[model samples]
Target: MSYEFITLKQEGRVLTISLNRPPTNPLNGVFGQELFKAFSEAEQMEDITVVIITSALEKAFIAGADIKEMAAQDAAEAEQFSKLLQGANNILNRMKKIVIAAINGHALGGGCELALACDYRLMTSGKALIGLPEAGLGIIPGAGGTQRLPRLVGLSKALDILLRGRTMSPQEALAIGLVDKLIEPENFQAEVMQFAQELAAGAGKALGYIKAAVYEGIDFPLEQALAVERKYSAENSKTHDAKEGLTAFVEKRRPEFKNE
Candidate 1:
């Protein structure tokens, strides 16, 4: 589970994964492979209830894909690389634990798509930018960008961004709902970790069920989605955390969820 291009740190119930390729953590074959390994490891950890994704560099979270590596790839190699990236992204999207993108700096192309895979995005204030800019490179986003971006920011806005290969400033990104929260640079890391830890402390089983209900339900018809939600709700109600939560509410005290 060791990673060469990324660093994993665990504290309490939260796991933080940092892209470690300095200068600009450009996505490459190795990066994608390492990311998949990291997520797989995280998924197996019993204590991990939340995951935060960020970068080790302050100047750029991830500038883009490794253009030099891309240029050296043949058609078959490029397709394989795309599939690898997509696989990594799918792991993030499908994780039961809550995933937050702590976007410290610019996140373009594949990096932006990576952020979109997370459940929440917290961006730093100031000049940091984020967007999918693959169109300018005579290519489209080969990862989940083309699908996830439109689902998140709506089809029209997503098209404008993709077609123009535009990058958005932090404030602009927030206005467009691409980012959930904008934190000042000085307190970015601390605040993001604090928020993640808060989420980790919640009822883990219920949180997982909520995530499943929303993620899986979105693709289903209204009736089917409601059924999906109802099923998870019924399952969650049988857990110890749900009982404790209800009892604590009546007792006027905080519930200590065991994630059982």
Candidate 2:
């Protein structure tokens, strides 16, 4: 579907969703719906094995929610607005495809929450900042930030930033394990594409199963988690790629994965 705030681009098996409501891709209901549509379609497409989320502008990946929009909402409308945005970004977590958030610039408030939904986050090694700094605005982050941030960076760390509305530098974000990698500004897009291409070329079924194992079992008890993992593993073994991979290993040849 065509989107006013986003653009879809496909390269090989990698699908890149570029948000472009510059000078900062501020979150809004229409943007939320469009984002949900983009990811929902990506989730079902067999040709796309990996998805990259990035901003078209270099100034800000997403600065925050549109304050003017938020200011006009009552409590009920605010809740609905928050949910809309959450549902959109949450698709990144639910999709089996490897989801990478390429933070090209500032990612604060809702922007940070969106990034948190991705399987991994890579940031440009520029002056861009990232955080969940909604407290200073007299509102708390309502888009899965409270839950996901704590799970990602620990309760104390997440709380400290959330309560204080403090923003962190890219280097600081990497140190706190918020962002997985930092690519130099000059080669950020190239490096992000390269990483996505590498992941897209892997055994698709195995990749999906691995993601399923983690998300499905993360909150389960040890035995339950193991059972979840085993179930996915058994399912993965049934794929053609799995058989070819094992056979190639035994034959001492490179396994050619067709993403089966």
Candidate 3:
């Protein structure tokens, strides 16, 4: 599907969704709408196992929210915009695919929130910065940032970063678990594609179920969380991949997962 603010490229089992709005990709009503559509479509695609969200722009993953648009918004408009973005962000967390954020450049404000929604983040080295700088702008992170950041890192660290509106380089972000990996800026795209392809080779259904189990179970108590794991575990045992995997083990051979 064509999008006004984003571009979709599919290769084998991997789907790459690039934020295409030029300069700083500002998160706005149209951008949010397009993002929602793209991710929603990706979530339903049976062939796609891994989804990679990145930037086509040279120096941005996404800079932030649309400040000018926000400044002009009345209460109702602000609420609508917030809801739109919140919905888009939630789709990322809920999607079955193993979603990855290839942070090629700066990811700030809503950008950081978007990245946080992904299953993993790999940032390009050099000038790329990632963080929630909303507090400095006389606001707070209205998207998933406020909630997800603290969950990934601890509460104390998230508070310090959010309150100061701090931005960190790829290394610093990795040190604090903001980003999962860092790649050389020069080889960033190639590395990201290789990473995505590796993940895409895995059993799609099992990968998704594992993601669902962890995300769903994290909020529950131990027993309830174990039940969540058991639910997904039982569900995955019925998959084609599961059968192939077990049969392959019995045969002492590698499993050829078709993601069926």
lDDT of each: 0.91, 0.91, 0.92
Pairs with backbone N, CA or C atoms under 3 Å apart (clashes), candidate 1: none
Summarize candidate 3's per-residue lDDT along 1-260 as a digit string, tens digits.
78898888999999999998888899888999999999999988999999999999999999998899899999899888878888988888888889999999899999999999999999998987899999898888887888999999999999999999999888899999999999998899999999999999999899999999999999999999999999999999999999999999999999999887
Please provide TM-scores, in order, for all candidate models, with all chains considered together. 0.97, 0.98, 0.98
lDDT of 1 by residue, 1-260 (tens): 67788889999999999888877998888888998899888877777889999999978988899999999999999999999988888888777889999999999999898899999999999998899888899989988999999999999999999999999999999998999999999999999999998998999989989998999999899999999999999999999999999999999999999878
| Poorest lDDT segment (10 consecutive residues) of candidate 2 | 87-96
Backbone clashes per model, in order? 0, 0, 0
Q: Candidate 1: lDDT of 34?
A: 92
> Model 2 lDDT vs. the true structure?
0.91
Range of the 10 consecutive residues with the lowest summed lDDT in candidate 3: 77-86
What TM value does model 2 have? 0.98
Identify the runs in model 3 with alpha carbons over 4 angstroms from their true place: none
54-107, model 2: which lDDT tens digit per residue?
999978999998999899999999999888888887788888789999999999
The pairs that clash in candidate 3 are: none
